[model samples]
Target: MKKLFLSCLFLLFFAVAQAVPAKSFYFTTSDSVKLYVRIAGEGKPCLFVHGGPGSWPKIYYALGGDVTEQDMTMIYLDQRGSGRSGGDDKTDYSLNRMVKDFEELREHLGYSKWLVMAHSFGGTQATEYAYQHPASINGVILVASTLHLKSSLESYIVEGARILNKPESEFRKEGASVGETLGKVVSQLNEQDLMYKVMYPKKEMFAQMNAVMDTTLNWHFGSKVWDLHEYEQDFTQKSASVKVPVLVVAGKYDYSVGPQHYRLFKFPKATYKTMATGHCPYQEQPEEFGKYVRKFVARLN
Candidate 1:
């Protein structure tokens, strides 16, 4: 009897010793889509929404959150059809559906509320989610986020033209879709190796971002963004209804999502800061980015 009790105690101790404070996993949504979700750090929960309308959370997880994570539990989620997530056969990437994904994740995690922070194109999805479900958010953080897709697309066209020494009008055709023109310009820019000029200040950092990414990701959300008219709406105008304190971090030279975009946001409670880097401020200026984000998150609790 004594030997059995000791054996049982040893097993229990081993299990307790291996326990983790947080988890890394893939959770299936109500629509039967699997999303890559990770829970890290401690304190209040903060959902880190990645941008690209189609990008993943990999780069941010690999480089950022060193300091901000110290203040809050950072929940990194790769949205449906992005990163390590699986896409649905119906191909429903609508605004309402994307917002519902966030809500369902929150429900699955059993959190009544959390802070939602997004970058680049993710501003659109995050803002819409917070607006549709204000009670589920404690605060919002937008890093180099674009609230107006059309204006940001124009910025890309103009900047890509200037870098390659070509006229912006060269890319645009009468009655052609903005998405089509943007694609042609982007293809030419990539061919000339000047695309990094618009996305990063040093140019080399763009390589750093690419290094950690999984090229296999389908990135289905990006190509479909222009097809959805709802995405064209000026998200800044709806910011006032979010009902949560917000932190807006902009990059002065980040033309990927116009540097001046932050000015258009109408958050009733907002804190704004503009950095000297490009679109991915978290990579170009990680320390300052972490500091600004940490301070903003600390104020919330």
Candidate 2:
């Protein structure tokens, strides 16, 4: 019995010592919805907000890992109703609610001030958040993000269609008519449609898009069509109030969000760069992307 007790004690200690830290946790929103968060590394805090108001935070794991290695405590948070977050409340997925969720998470983590790196739709959230809570943020990074929704989206679709080598006659005809009908046409296309084929050439990209689209559509709070008119006034009015350093990253081939939208942000303290890839620059060129981010953060230090 003594030997067995000693053996059990030893095993318990071994298990405790070998256990990987709890790198993730779930927190409740003010509305009582549960949200998931993953955190790693240790140093200056940097949170990576994902694109697609409904997309899971895991999409940034690779990039977060790279950033964390440089002594940055990287955080990836799934928006309400995405990934492991608990809530069937589609009605609670609005942009404002999402921003509240971000603020709550920041407070929960006890981060007095931290850097924010947001991608695509996540950029939209980060921009709005920065506008509202500039004092809480140390810096902001926008990746392939846009502000002028209608015009920028139109340009993105037309350019994307052209790159697919669709017949020029179809292009010329559609280009002229796209402004009025592009949203309808895009809505009709599903995860397996040819539109995605043109936009995402890689097999992995299709898988990623499908996952993101599933979550986005599942928890969409408002009209299927993104209405910038509702938020445009607020966005512009609040954006001018931002006083922190900002970095806007674009990809040359990013026909999805396009480059024109970046110009709309008139931050007095903003730096913009265009990469040689598409919507997802970090995945397309992780090493270069990581280097650029590190250099930017170094400047802040």
Candidate 3:
């Protein structure tokens, strides 16, 4: 009985020792709102901004892994009103406030310069952040992002709905509507139903979609009144004036924000590429995405 108890204690100790806890930190925004951040790896800082103004930082874990292997420090931040962040005042959820949050986080981290890797909506935030603070950015990697929310969301919905065999009338009616109503209709979709059936046709896509759906639902509910029009106006103006070493990456099957949207952006110096995958190309093809990011950053050096 003594020997068995000792053995059980040893097994428990080994299990606890092997467990890797995700590192967490906090940065206070200019408005005194506390923002949460997670960091991994070491070397030049590569701040990763997630899509959905309300998205959690965990979505970038796969990309962070790639950055880590390349000796790059990965910074994942949940924007205000997002995962583990403080913003009880929903009014604090504007795009300008979000931009300030990034600036404050950078100041708190004590980084004079850093690279940025952002996805979908995160890409938009990254671009705006770079534009406002050009000297603070070393370079930028934009993955499946767009300047205009209307065009991007419309294209995504239409393409996804068509792929899912959703009725054209339902899409058309939703398209004519505005704001939270449109988003609500899109959010309540069953993962294995029409949208997933069409947008995610492959087995691997189904797996990825399942993961994305959970976080996405949380974000959609948390930020139900996201002002897309204001977001679009601000991004379009900022994107045209950016002069950083920008790499715009899109997935070939990304109905979310098609390549056409990237073409509309007036970046002063931008290199664009489309991967042979869908929206979350980093997960679908991490090696390729990492290779591209490494090559792009090298060019800046």
Candidate 4:
């Protein structure tokens, strides 16, 4: 009886595993950190690098699901210390180390050239990776990503306050009253509150940010090192060296990166698309987002 029950359990496990199309594995980095990776579909390979210095790739699943339906294989990875990946040393979150993790993952998966897709902070990561290993990247897709951090933050504060119908000076005054910078004051507010007031500013987009906020908030605050420390390298000069096919999708009202900051990159082969959403266009406007991706990938072929 015991043997029969064990056999049935084994069969159930196998069936469930087979039911899911995605194949998941652990890719160990040079520092021995085992990061989680998920691969689905089959065709041209494309990787999705999620935002949030500490965010996991799982949040991209909503968009990944749609991408998989197209003619491309989707790879999702939880950067070291973020998702199912193993990480005891937060110091490993440095830019070089993070880039190394991505490079090693691509080598481990046996892909020579793959399209890189990044959102928010992941945009910085994608650029770093492409700059370092140009031979390994076929194209890049940046969604509301920024190349200049300080400028982006400043724009967010100025434009964000304006959208909220609150003067930037007023926000500065409030922050000063609390002995904090305006940016710090803005950071303290929850995603929904901030999105409703300044970031998205539209009722529809604001409502859609809830799930994204819930997931990212948990990931963002979970880290101590990468979350607080500044990235070691500034790739402003290296950014100009990126000649890969680039597709930038920006949110017209995204307070995070500021729409104007999109001009910072000078990719030789580049295409730009503006959406009527906030930071997470894939979540707020999935259909349009998918269309943009499909068209970009198609043009590359």
Candidate 5:
């Protein structure tokens, strides 16, 4: 009886979801990897590149991330081997290939150009995408991005160690890789139940993040991206060569990517802001985020 009732509820939910006037579908990349993409809203087109290397765009969009939709068409793409997306048999996750996927999607959609907004680790991919395919993008927006993962990992050791009341030297590198050191320190913070301190302001709100992100998703990009030598380059240095107009948002309390890391960026036509929130200023401080985003986007139109 209860099983039947639950099944009915699930069907009803699916029915309602289908009823909504939403557009979502899958696209096959040149490498034969299938990826999921959802297009909605109006005005200028803007692609959203999510973080976690493997993270999906759903949580952010679920958490009122659609605020930018008012001013632009939102293209929420789940990167290959990510949320609701299929993987490549060749196991290719190269930076150039990733950017090529974005370009191919643009050409597939028949768009001359679009804007791109990247978050956290996705910023690495977005930065590369903008540099290699500037002709296909009108502008780029980076939120709480880490151009240098090494810098971000060190931040986790320092800030997370401080929160756990552990000495940073305990996790310091002794010929170990930066990625390994980061894993050790971040594990400590998560074990102590102090991860919120490393990325959020409070436990309750942080719980909301976990509630939306579940274990059923694929995490291939996050699992393999760190070891990729191509991503290890200091994208901040390359920032100076990127001519795309940029909007950069940094957090005052975001130790995950280093709160003040934006200082290292050198995008020539960039507008910068430092929010009092943590790594997720878009969710924590949406109005302020929307204001600058809308203003910047308006200028592009």
Candidate 6:
């Protein structure tokens, strides 16, 4: 009995020793904005750029916690002014500023080159980063991303109409009748409305939606930079210039940044795949999403 108890204690200690905690740190941006960074998992470095010009990094955690099992050193970064990162309402949340933050973060982390994984609006930022510093990127992964913000916003309006059970023509007429700007409509959308009412309506996905909403809505300046950038942006030539290995995972039911629009990207080394869900495919179908992600990164390895 004494021997057995000692053996059990030894095994338990071994198990506890094997568990690794994530490494957390904060890095200050050029403008002195301190951003939160979480380095989890082991193996090759893979930096995750989350969406929402203002969305936090936790949304990706809600989607799929870590890709460690796929042999990746997952770097989850909460962009400046979002999540645990420090930022004020008056801070410069411009697109170029955001891109520079990522570049600086990479250098600060001591990574020569790493795979960039982006989702939703993050895709645009990641693409821009790669375009500006192609040599610093090993590969690019775009999930439900868009090249043109204005066009993508317009697509969502069309999609929102369909989800509302109204004809496309009628929806457009109503928009004109009410004079509702695209930014006005989009800024008001919560995860509950976008996930349950429109896209993934199942009860199973509701919790995931809640997780996303809770974290995303905490960002004090939600969509403020997004709307401003879209109002004065076009990326046709810039997007085409991304010569790095690109993998775009789009959602079939995504109305916001429709899969069709992603198809318009002319990245010379790009490969596209449409997942079987809506805007938040990573959150909706994490298992399959991880599978595709693993395969894509495996090639880079």
* Candidate 1 lDDT tens digits, 43-152: 78989888888888877867654456666788999988888888844668889998998999999999989999898889998999999999999999999899889989
Kindly list the per-residue Cα lDDT of model 5 for residues 1-301, writing each as its tens digit: 9999999999999887544354999999988888899987777999999998789998677776778877788899999878888874356888888888999999999999999999998888899898888899999999899998888878877897788787878887689887778788878877878889888886766887788896788777777776788888889998898998999988899999999788999999999988898888878888898898999998885
lDDT of each: 0.86, 0.67, 0.70, 0.72, 0.86, 0.74
| Maximum-lDDT candidate | 5
Candidate 3 ranges beyond 4 A from true positions: 1-22, 62-69, 178-192, 197-203, 212-225
lDDT of 6 by residue, 84-130 (tens): 88777778877778888888988998999999988787877788889
Task: Give the RMSD in angstroms, all C-alphas superposed, for model 6.
Answer: 3.9
Scored against the true structure, residue 193 in model 4 reaches a CA lDDT of 61
User: Model 6 lDDT vs. the true structure?
Assistant: 0.74
95, model 6: CA deviation in Å? Answer: 1.9
Residue pairs clashing, model 5: none
Give the CA lDDT, 0 to 100, for residue 205 in model 6.
70
Best by TM-score: 5
Candidate 4: deviation at residue 77, Å? 0.8
Worst-scoring 10-residue span by lDDT in model 3:
216-225
Stretches of candidate 1 exceeding 4 Å from the true structure: 1-22
What lDDT is obtained when candidate 2 is compared to the true structure? 0.67
| TM-score-better candidate, 2 vs 4 | 4
| Poorly placed runs, candidate 2 (over 4 Å) | 1-22, 62-71, 163-180, 183-237
How many steric overlaps are in each model, in order?
0, 0, 0, 0, 0, 0
Residue 53 of model 3, lDDT score: 56
Angstrom error at residue 3, model 2:
36
* Clash list (residue pairs), candidate 1: none
